[model samples]
Target: MSAELAVVYAALILQDDQIEITSDKLQTLVKAAGIEVEPVWFSLYAKALAGQDLKALLLNVGAPGAGGAAAATGASGAAASTEAAVEEAVEEKEESDDDMGFGLFD
Candidate 1:
């Protein structure tokens, strides 16, 4: 896998195990896995995730129809709205492509 994907997988594992995901933790995981990635990527990942709810973000990611139902409920719903919006946006793009009389590959 790519370094970024490896880092994300490490973070997911840490989260699943109830460990805080941090640059140091990511570094240790990556090193233990025998992957050599640039230190800058770790810093970037840390910065990007700072002050964000990683669990919620992970839960909502790539889950299409369920996001709308989740968001319609309450505070836990807010994060899911992002996912729903993404799904709608993807649908819109696909519809627009159909209207254009050409496949994306064309």
Candidate 2:
């Protein structure tokens, strides 16, 4: 995190490994890190999360650590565990296919 990134708040809407950070994150990143945030941060944060995945989530970034709120990740983050399981299943299927010579071109 750069000095510019320190004070600026960043939020990401992630689907898969791809991410789209809200506009506020953009400004927060634009400004120097460790800088105190103005009201603009909240306003933009709301606008960015509005009608998106955030409506269902209760997020708090009050910690002195990483920007990702531990609260946001609670039980909801459990869904991500399924992603790993799904990947494992896919790999297993691929292996089975390979063993069966399914990938061999006729």
In model 1, pairs of residues that clash are none
Instruction: Tell me the TM-score of model 2.
Output: 0.27
The parts of candidate 2 lying over 4 Å away from their true place are: 1-73, 104-106
**TM-score quality measure for candidate 1:** 0.56
> How do all models score by TM-score?
0.56, 0.27
Tens-digit per-residue lDDT, 13-82, candidate 2: 2312234545554454545344555656545664656555542344533342344554466655646765
lDDT of each: 0.82, 0.52
Give a tens-digit lDDT track for model 1, residues 1-106: 7999988888877878978778999899999999989998888887787666789887778765666665567665666776798899999999999999987799
- What's the residue-level lDDT of 14 in candidate 1? 80
